[model samples]
Target: MQCRIISIGNELLIGDTVNTNASWLGNVLTEVGIDVTHIYTIGDDLATMKDILSEALSATDLIITTGGLGPTHDDITKRAVTELFDCELVLEDSVLDFIKKVFKKRNIPFSKSNYHQAEVPDCCEVLFNTHGTAPGMWFDRGSVKLAVLPGVPHEMKHLVNEKVIPKVRAINGDTEFRRSHYITTAGIGESTLSDEVVGSLVDVLPEHVSVAYLPSPQGTRIRISAYGSSDDEIDERIAPVRDHIKQKAEKYIIGEGKDLNLAKAVGDLLVEHEMLISVAESCTGGYLANAITDVPGSSRYLMGGLVAYANQVKENQLGVSTDDLNSHGAVSKPVALQMAKGVAKQLGADIGVSTTGIAGPSGGTEEKPVGTVWIGFWNQDEHFAIKAHFTNDRQINKERSGAVALEMVRRSIMGIKEMPYGFKKYPA
Candidate 1:
């Protein structure tokens, strides 16, 4: 089934409220084998609501709208829906009784405006919401289905899971079930991974399976989804495509599961290899350490970290040479390498990683410009540093540098020779 979501509120348009309802609904609907096409966010205007509702219903077989279903005057969704369906407003006695009991329990007098909450169109079926005052409405016109729900997140979610989904399944019986598998990869850009490494999924996937490349600051999550009636059937159908991707992108793929990040991947590898690691930070501050410790059970392999932001700390704490700092500066490869090796030796760790860079809107020289990062790695066997130039945004540079540093650790431990972003390691 094809579906569209309409989020109605002046708060959403004015940036007072985020449109999280649409995203939640889209994920839920897509899991049930419904293809969600568009999401429309509009203000609480009556004419606009009616026009958008009409257009959405005309284009898609299923339409879901959330918001503007309160007792206040700004809540005009019920009115718009009633006018569009040309139905008379009728008071539901059960809903009115429930609202009255709720108010009485809270020791508040129910006013005339509160009665509006119990009113529904004569032609629609009411989906009782025990969590809140607003009742969900369901209207079926021939083949098109429209459901009007409350704007509150908890109430909407409860109604969707308890009421709406059951009704939808009853209407469309024995349909295909959808499942998705995520293959995460790092140390590569999206274009390079897609165009060169994992090219042309057409021959790899079956007719029922599809692929989507979701990119973030940390890495890219390759999603492979398929539809089937049974779990075994779905898994069997997707096996060939999944294996083909793993074979092609074996070097770059970090781990499986949708919520996997670079930190978790590196931590897992560290535990497997029985190694401990430490970090010395300059430009990225504590971001590298924070990312590493974000994963649970990180203490098993994470030794410690030092944010040596100043030259004095670099020389005093991490034992970076004063001569090298004076000659090559803090952002240079020599200082980066020294910091990594020094931290590893001082902290008694099997491996050490360091990040030194110029991340800023200001502080740029012709030779060492902004976002010029030197990431260093040191182990008992080898020690080297790689140079990377990121964006001018400080936050972006920090995130990119941290991700690359973790990926570098993962690659080095796994005996991979290539560096992140294809940058050659200095002093090779």
Candidate 2:
């Protein structure tokens, strides 16, 4: 089965709103073994809406539309859909009563325009949406099934999961399902990880398996996707490719599963080792600490953090040496080392991590230029710092630095000598 998603809104076209709905629908549809062939993001124009609807009905097995289902003047999706189906708009008392009850619960006065929300095309089955004001509708036009849903993300997701997926599941019973397994890696560039590290997949991939490298600011995820009738068959198909990539990139592979991340991996290791960790950040501010604390049960391992953005804060709070700040500057190796050790002592933590850098579009010098970062680590047995060069973008630099810091902690806990990104670790 194939699906087409039509997004109707001027805000999306004008870049005011993101077209996340289409992407979400695409992923969900694909997981159910339905191929999402086309995504049409148009404005709230009646003519274009009617044309796209007509085209999708003729071209695809399923059609889902989002947006333009409001009470405003520009909300013309329902009208266009009704006109195309040659049906009259009839009021559904159940839907109207629900809307009225919701409004009364919120202590809001009901208006005439809201009455339009309860009216549905005579040719469609009302897919009741309890999450929002607009009720979703389903129409079976010959071969194609059209599910018109609200543009609100939560409402759309609710309707799809509650009402639409069951129908799709019934129609696609016992058929092949599309699924993916993700191997997440941090502190590695996409090009280097793909071209040199993972190498070619020509011989490793099975008959129906494929690999894709998804890179972001924090890390890279290698997706091993396959099609099979059951989970066991898909697992068998992807195992060879997954094992091969793991073998090739063993040290860099942080964890598996689609939602695996550096912070969660680090938190797990910290828990296993029964160690408490503290963070002292300079250029990255509280980003490193926030990432760590984002994981659940992090309180067991994460002691605390300090955002020592100012030189005085670095000295007075983290106890970075006054001499080093004057001589080597804040973004130097000595300061990084001292900051890491100082934070550990200050918080009485078993381990301390620090990031000091010039993350910039500016604030660079001849010797210490932009994107120059020094990440430090300190424990009872060992203390060292790793220097890395990153991008010109400030946000990217921050994300990469935080990721590298987490990866460094992970490697050290696992007793892996190899440094993240193969950078030389400088001893204090």
Whole-model lDDT per candidate: 0.92, 0.92
Model 2, 175-268: lDDT tens per residue? 9999999999986789999999999989887798888999987789999889999999999999999999999998888899988899999999
Please report the candidate that would top TM-score against the real structure.
Answer: 2
Q: Estimate the Cα RMSD of every predicted model relative to the unseen true structure.
A: 3.9, 1.6
Pairs in clash, predicted candidate 1: none
lDDT of 1 by residue, 194-270 (tens): 98999998887788999999987798999989898878988998899889889999999999997899999999999
Q: Tell me the TM-score of each prediction against the true structure.
A: 0.83, 0.96
